[model samples]
Target: MATAGGGNAHMVFRRYLDAVGLQGLASAEAAGLHTSEWYALSLITLEGSLSSGELASRTGLTTGATTRLIDRLERAGYARRAADPHDRRRVI
Candidate 1:
């Protein structure tokens, strides 16, 4: 059971999430991208840079799906993959 204050907080958080989702949808549409692409872009922007594997984990997408997502983002000029500075074998 939640206290009244806790319930209000939950409502506020839910509203915030809804607002963010709406904004994200609008942004994605403006950018000519799918919602998932926008989400991946958001994650990348938040992290500054991350590996595709890390992105997959964060997005709850499989490696192949994440790869495809990255492909679309790259094609749309929203993101780029580069070799990690210290690890040539890893991409960022």
Candidate 2:
């Protein structure tokens, strides 16, 4: 059904999501990152940094997969992990 504004919510949301995805793809190409990696990078940049577990949760990936993603990103020199100052067990 269409919303009061004459737009179908689902269609509108899908368009907005698609536009964002396209923009991400373009940005990823420019930055030499995979599209999924770019999305992760965007989240990291938006929040300065986050723990691997947090990143995994946000990206809807397994922690192991997220670790692999981080490894790739690190090797590409796009990101690095550091021990959190207040907590040595955590990577930031």
Q: Rate the local accuracy (lDDT) of all candidates.
A: 0.91, 0.89
- Model 2 C-alpha lDDT per residue in residues 1-92, reported as the tens digit of each score: 44556457777888999998898889999988887799899899898879999999999989998999999899999999999998999888
Candidate 1, clashing residue pairs?
Answer: none
Candidate whose lDDT is highest: 1
User: Candidate 2: deviation at residue 74, Å?
Assistant: 0.7
Model 1 stretches with alpha carbons more than 4 Å out: 1-13
Best candidate, TM-score-wise?
1
Across 11-80, the per-residue lDDT of candidate 1 in tens digits comes to 9998999999899999999989989988899899888889999999999999999999999899878899
Instruction: Report the C-alpha displacement of residue 91, candidate 1, in angstroms.
Output: 1.1
For model 1 the TM-score comes to 0.80
